[model samples]
Target: MKALIPTGDPAEPVVLADVPEPVPRANEALVKVEAFSVNRGETFKLEAPAPGDRPGKDIAGLVVQPAADGTGPAGIARVVGHPMAGGWAELAAVPADALAVLPDTVSALQGAALPLAGLTALRLLRTAGPVLGRRVLVTGASGGVGHFVTELAAAAGAEVTAVTRDAARGARLTELGAAAIVHDPADARGPYDIVLESTGGETLPVALARLARRGTLVWFGQASRTPATLDFFDFFDGPESAVIRHFHYLDADTGLGDDLAALVRLTAEGRLHPEIGRVADWADTATVLTDLRDRRIRGKAVLTLS
Candidate 1:
């Protein structure tokens, strides 16, 4: 089996190898991985699979065996919480409960991109309640995470205001259901109900100033490649003005099952459309990662295993 292995290099992980196939212990499933995608931002925290390890977060495939990790199977509770590893190979073993069966309505490439970005958007928009009819401001609306949030918010009936700097993609953003698209990075037309901040760095502070009183701000990812710096008290400083809720997708983890299932169902029903910017084969993984690390791609990039 050929798996993408991470070399200890901080710049980018090397994908090369003919490794052994993994066997499911208990409550696990062996998925014949058809396709997978790379979350370029993941390189910040995780290197790659060690010599004996596998790397892949978002995946789409079929189950060939059951679990061996002492967990149960055939339930939505199990499949969405913890996604199986090894999405970069032709076949990899994942916990059965971690699997979200892809709907026939979506393609393998689309299915592969669904697990992470889709789940993040669902968690922000659907989990714990609803944000329908509210006003949402999604920063970085032209990118993967940002674009998904825009669609999910609009789907829930929220008047979405997508913030973007890409002039070429403004029309696409409108097609994705953004009530409005603005190129101004720091401009805030507040009274915003929900603000999803995908851009950090200096933009983080600017975003902090735009939220409506008691507004919920969810930080899904920092695509700007810069850490956020701000005085938290400024927003909360004026008790009458607003509230701040900073977060990472994994911050409030619920086993990842329900969220993934929700995304899959939406895709299967043709209600959800994930933006996939590039689809590269396993051999091109290196060049793709380099491109992503340097911010060369627009939307999520999928890597297929043959």
Candidate 2:
């Protein structure tokens, strides 16, 4: 089997190499991967040399072997999931608890895009509590998680305002159901009930300021790669009720498989749409990682395993 791993090169970090097949534990499922998606966090991890040289987490495929305990979909059922690592291979040994059975109507490409980003967005929204008729704000609206946040917020009847640095992608976000689009954080109509903010640095302070009373700000990603400086005076001056919460996708556990199942169902029903920026052969993993790290790709990038 072949798997993609990070080499110690800044210009081109990922490389594909032959690897031994994994033997699943009694509680795991062996999935024969058909497609997978590259995530920005995975690319960021490449900056520091990978200890085991293993990469990848999100995968969508058919079940070759089900869990020994008979927990999830079995016998050639299509599924999407996240392994701790080594998902950039022909087969991945995923915990049965993390695997979601994909509907027949969804493609592997779309399902592959769901696990990491989709789960994060779902969890963030869940953290923000009920969004119906509330004012919600989503930053980095063109990115994978951002798009999901925007769509999910809107579907829940929230008045969604999407923020993107790129003007061109604004129309697509509006189509995704954002009630309004703003290019800068300052332009966002504020006192938002729920703010799903991904970009850090200068934007964080502004987003915090926009939170309404009892509003929740779910900070997930640091795309800016700069430190976020918090002003105690600015944050505490007023809006004492506003809450700032930093969300790391990995922290919320126990519902990944169920959340992924719901996302797949939403996608298949056309209520949630995943934006696939590019699709490439598995061998082109290096290029895909480079594009994602450099922000050359607008949305999720998919790699297909032949």
Residue range with the least summed lDDT across 10 consecutive positions in model 2: 246-255
Alpha-carbon deviation at 148 in model 2, angstroms: 0.7
Question: 28-103 in candidate 2: lDDT tens per residue?
Answer: 9999999999998888889887478677789999999999998877879899988888899988999998999988
Give Cα-based local distance difference scores for all models.
0.71, 0.88
For model 2 the local lDDT of residue 49 reads: 73
Q: TM-score, each model?
A: 0.87, 0.96
Best model number under TM-score:
2
User: Which lDDT value does model 1 have at 195?
Assistant: 76
Candidate 1 segments exceeding 4 Å error: 9-12, 46-53, 68-84, 127-129, 236-241, 251-255
Q: Clashing residue pairs, candidate 2?
A: none
